[model samples]
Target: MSWELVSGLETHVELSTNTKIFCGCTTKFGGEPNTNCCPICIGLPGTLPKLNRQVVHYAIMAGLATHCTINNVSKMDRKNYVYPDLPKAYQISQYDKPLCEHGYIQLDNGRKIGITRIHIEEDAGKLVHEHGDTFVDYNRGGVPLIEIVSEPDIRSIAEAREYVEKLQMIMKHIGVSDCKMQEGSLRCDVNISVRPEGSNEFGTRTEIKNMNSFTNMEKAMAYEYDRQIDLLESGGKVTQETLRWNPDEGITTPMRGKEDAHDYRYFREPDLVTIYTTDEEIEAIRQELPELPDARIARYESDFGLPEADAQLLVKYRKIAEYFEAAGEGLANKKTVANFILGQIFRTLVTDEEKENGAVAIPPEYLHDLAKLLEDGKIKMNLAKTTLDKMLETGKPCTDFISEQDMGDIDEDTLRTICQSVVDNNPKAVADFKGGKDKAVKALIGQVMKQTRGKADGRKAEAMMVDMMNDME
Candidate 1:
């Protein structure tokens, strides 16, 4: 019998606060191990936790962005657990009284995936194991996190990946989180099961824990889906357990038995009282939110005349989208600006070194000017691309390089002279064009451009070359 996959995700997004959630320790990504920790974060004796107001504000912003209803009063609870990375044997998190609930994220196909809740919690420490020794770093221990739990509405691996990518884009656009998978800022736990097609009863589910990359998330889900289906088809029972995805081997290995909520022994924390928010405060935050990805995409398509695909690409990154809008403002042919950014500007950022450090060196104004030059036909596309490469390498304005190289449209007299030379030099090409081979003129125009160092206007030179070829005929 054929089976269908049912999946949901529990995403942990690290908030972009300067300090840890309940302590004054730094939340920076990389530092000397344990140096970013403090008494409260490290769970030292005699230390009390104080909540960060910014963390709450950010949580509310996240809730609002995802259409979640913000809770007026939420309380922190102690999630009792024992782990080497969790300095606090019992983690301070939200249990029954989470900050937000009942939200949804709409996929591009208009399918709405329901969100169960979004709760604020502190991150656990990092465990670095090398040569039979395990080292714990508390630098990330108290970093603020918002765990977004989705419903089991996801049906396929592609939907699972799209859901995560869309969430990453939204969070990044709103400046709530960087959502960098490499830095461990954004991570996911996938709960998936398989059931017979058209059956209401769900199969035994398995949890894939702490997948950091979206690609890995999809791969892991795909592997688990097959594993469950194959086991049931072979007359074996699917077990409920936690699994780890080995990307190197492309398989999911069983980690441990899955634990239910009651297993954690969750209870309300006594140290922190019930947190509260007012409608006025929520409204103020809602007003302060920037244009989200959806609105920006709509504006790009309707106002800027961009195709939906191009608009989606431009808005994929917040910084890139803002740069595109700033440079393309008041310019004719805004689509040209989009193309240059996605094509030439993106190509220049080749190496990771160039991408990390050299991207900001070349100003957006250079791109704007280059697009303008192309739009006005002052320089053809081939010359513009060469100048763009040099601009990226030297961080100089496009005009300065254009002037130094004397790059501009070749005069009509010079273009005609070059075309005549090309036609005379290739009698066979001239005869081909005259014999009704329309494409042969392109070769003659290419010769003119080569002679003029890409300074000749291609359309004008093509016309000139056709005229010169006809004269010989």
Candidate 2:
């Protein structure tokens, strides 16, 4: 039987607060292990957790951005669990009284993924294990996190990936979280179940973990779907368990059984007071939200006349979008700006497949200047590309490199002179061109391009060659 994949995601986005949720410890990354911990965060005796008011404000902002109904009163509950990484032995999180509910994000296919709830919680510390020894760091403990739980509205790997991306974009645009996957500021756990194509009931769902990037998220979910489908087809039963995605191995390994709400043994925190927010406050946050990505993408397509594909690609990074708008300002060169961004700038700044850092480091303003220079015809296309590569290396603007090397486009007179020389040097090509051969004219243009060291615009040279060859006729 052909099966369909059903998936949902529970993403934990660490709020970009300056301090830990309950303590005064810093929430900055890459400090000495356990240095950011305090009695309140490390769960020491005689310590009590105090809720961070900023965390609630951020949570409400997130809810408003995603079109969720913000709760007027939300309480914190003790999520009882035991793990080496969790120093508190129980995480202070929201259970039944989450801060927001009933949100949705529209995918590219125009289907909305329903958000079940968005709740605030504290992050657990990390475990470092090597050579049969293990250590724990409480630095990450008490870092504020907003866990966004989505319903099983996702039906494919593609949909799952889009939902995650949309959610991340929402968080970033609203300034709720940095959503940096490498720094563990944002993390996701995917739940997948496969059932017959037309069945209404769901199959046993397996949860996948350890997905660090969007590509890995899509790939791991696809691989797991195939794995589960193969097992079910061969008469093997699907188990409800937690599986870890080993991106290196490109496979999912069974970790443990899945846990339900009761497994955590949640209870209201007696020490912390319940917080209440007003509708007017939530409305104020709603008004403060910046233009969202979807709306921006639409405006980019309509206002800038950018193709849908190019607009979508450019809007993925807010830095690039801002750069595009700035470069396009007051210049009557919108198309040229779009072309440079979608064409040259993208090529030079995105080398994820070849580079170790997985991203290019060219400054945004430099890209803007490069596009402007190209629009003014100040440099040949080949030279612009070369200048861009060098700009990526040196992080300098195009004008600096061009002035240092005197590498602007060759003058029209100099181009014609080089074309004449090429035509005079290639007698056979000239003779063939006079004999009504257009291909030989291209040959003469190639010679001019080679003689100029690829600095001449081949189109300009080709036009000059036709004129030069006709003069000999």
Candidate 3:
């Protein structure tokens, strides 16, 4: 019997607010344990928790970006729990009344994963286990976070990855959070269940706690799917439990029984007041939103005549998209700009972090200058591309490497004379071209470029060379 997978993700995104959600403590990462803490963060007696206004604004912006409806009135609730990391025995969060509700993030395949709610909350501290002792760091405690709950719309591992990646991109684009998983800024709680194929009813679900990276998400989901299928096949029912993914052993161990809403013993937070936002305020925030990734990708394809894949690659990273536009300014063929970014620039920025941060040595205007030279026929692609590499290395302009003679193309008559001389000099290649070897013409063009000291346009020369070969008897 074939088993199908149904999955939903509860993604916790740490907002980039300067202070803790309910206090004025700094929200900086990697501080000494308990050093960044204040009385409010450590839940000292007689301290009142005050809400951060910026947290509410950033949450609304996130809600708007993900196509969610912003609730006009919302209130925070206290979720009671006993853990050393949560200095406050009760964490302040939103339950029934969240800041944003009923949102959906659309994937490339036209599937909209429903988001249940995006609520403002405060994060617990880090529990580091070393040498059989658990040390608590209150630095992250009371840090602002917005939990995005998604409905069980994911069916496959690929869709799960896309959903998470889309969410990550959206959050980063809105400038809400860094979404750096390594730093615990963005983490996912994956809820997975497996049922018989073509069945409408969902099987018993098990929750996996806090998957940080995409590779781990994919591997963990795949393993959990197989594990559940095996259990069902053996006539054993799966348990409803919370589990942890062990990357080293490639298995999920039971953490504890799954907790429902009632498990938390929720109540209204007495310290914080109700949050009320008006429609005018929501619209003002919506206006602050820059062009999102999907719209930009569509525009790149329609306006620049770029391929869909090319557009997606450039638009995935915020900095790369901005750099592409700035570099493409006033250029007739924007696709040339895309090619350079997707080709040469991407070749250097190999890692996702480097690409996401736009860690290129040269400025966007430097790229614009290089693209202008190519469009104006001042230099061929071969020379422009090589010069781009040099620019990337030295943060210098193309003029530093391209001389005046190398700037302009050889004259038409001179180019043709050079082409004929090359054809005569390389009869074997000409014969190879006559015999239907299409790549042989490249050798002829290579000679033309070499003879002109990279001054000749490789593309134009290729076209002219191919034509001359076709006309040969």
Candidate 4:
């Protein structure tokens, strides 16, 4: 019997605010275990909680970016739960009235996974089980979080991965969160189940708690899907429980039975008033939003003439996209700026984390100046590339490495003579290029570049060589 997979993701994004959601505690990532905490964040008595105004603004921004309808009025509720890491034994969150609803994140394959709700909540602390002893740290407690719950519209692991990726990209681009999975700023809980193919009715589903990385998410979901199908095939029942993914052992271990809404015992909070937003407020926030990834990607392709893959890669990270936009400002060849970043500048920051951090030392104007030289026909691409490497290495301008003597391209007649000499001297390379080894022309161009001291344009040199080859024919 064929079985199909069904899944939904509950993603928690830590807002990029300076303070905790309901207190003045610093929301910095790392500190001495409990040094960053205070009375209100740890729920001390006689201390009242105050909601951070920036948190609400960021939540609304997240809603607008994801195409969700922002609710004008919403209130906070106490979510009752017992946990060692939660100082209050109940987290402040929303139940019936959330900030955003009925949004969807579209995948690259044109599939829209419906987002159920995006609600603001407080984060719990961390528990470290060391040497069979448990230790708790309350530093992360009361941190602001926005829970993005998606409808069970995901039918495969690819959709699940893309959904998370799209969310990560959107949140980062909107400047609300860094969305770093490794830093615990972004987390996921996946609900997965399997049913007989072509069946509409849902089956018993188990939740996988806190998948941090894409590799783990994919592996855990695939394992759980197969596990459910096998159980159903053997006439065994699929249990509704929350499971922990053991990455080393590659299996899902049951943690506890799944709880419904009533399990939380939610109630309206007395300390906080209802959040009200006027049309003017929402519109004001809307106007503050920067260009989102999809829109920027489209403009990069349509206006800047970048390939889809290049445009997507550039827009994947906010800092890189910003740098590219600034570097390519008022330039005729925008792709040249992209090439400098993707080709040479990226080589300096070899890791994705480094690239995402935009660690390239050279300023955008340095690249813009170098590309400008290329544009004005004053410098060949080879010289521009070499000068860029120097600028990146020394944090100097292109003029620092390239002197006035090296600033001019060879005249057309002079370039024609160099090309003829290259063709005549490299008879074997020319024969190979004529015999259909297109890359063989590089050797001929190398000779011309060497003779001209890198002042000869490789493209024009190659074109002149092709013209020479045509004359021979």
RMSD (Cα, Å) for all candidates, in order, is 2.8, 4.2, 2.5, 2.6
Model 2 lDDT vs. the true structure? Answer: 0.82
Alpha-carbon runs more than 4 Å astray in model 3: 257-262, 420-441, 459-473
Per-model TM-score versus the true fold = 0.91, 0.83, 0.93, 0.93
Q: For residues 340-458, write the lDDT of model 3, one tens digit per residue.
A: 88988898898999999998778889999999988998888888888999999899987788888888768888988888889888989999999989999988888998898778877
Put down candidate 4 lDDT per residue, 1-473, tens digits, no spaces.
89989999999999999999998889999888998899988888888889999999999999999999999999999989888889888899998999999999988888899999999999999999999999988999999999999999999999999999999999998989998899889999999999889999999999999999999999999999999998999999998888999999999998864453238788998889999988899989999999989999999999999999999999998899999998999999999999989998988988988888988898898889999998988988888888889899999989898888788968899999989988988888888988989998898888988888789878888998987986786
lDDT at position 113, candidate 3: 97
lDDT of 2 by residue, 148-257 (tens): 99999899888888888898878876778878888888889999999999999999998887577888888888898999999999999898888898888989998865
Better of 2 and 4 by TM-score: 4
Model 4 worst lDDT window (10 residues)? 255-264
Greater TM-score among 1 and 4 belongs to: 4
TM-score of 4: 0.93
Candidate ranking under TM-score, highest first, comes to 3, 4, 1, 2
Global lDDT for candidate 4? 0.92
Q: Give candidate 2 misplaced runs (Cα > 4 Å).
A: 131-133, 234-236, 246-253, 257-262, 347-422, 431-461, 467-473
The residue ranges of model 1 lying beyond 4 angstroms of the native Cα positions read 131-133, 257-262, 351-361, 377-379, 403-418, 431-440, 450-455
The lDDT values for all models are 0.87, 0.82, 0.91, 0.92
How displaced is residue 472 in candidate 1, in Å?
Answer: 3.1
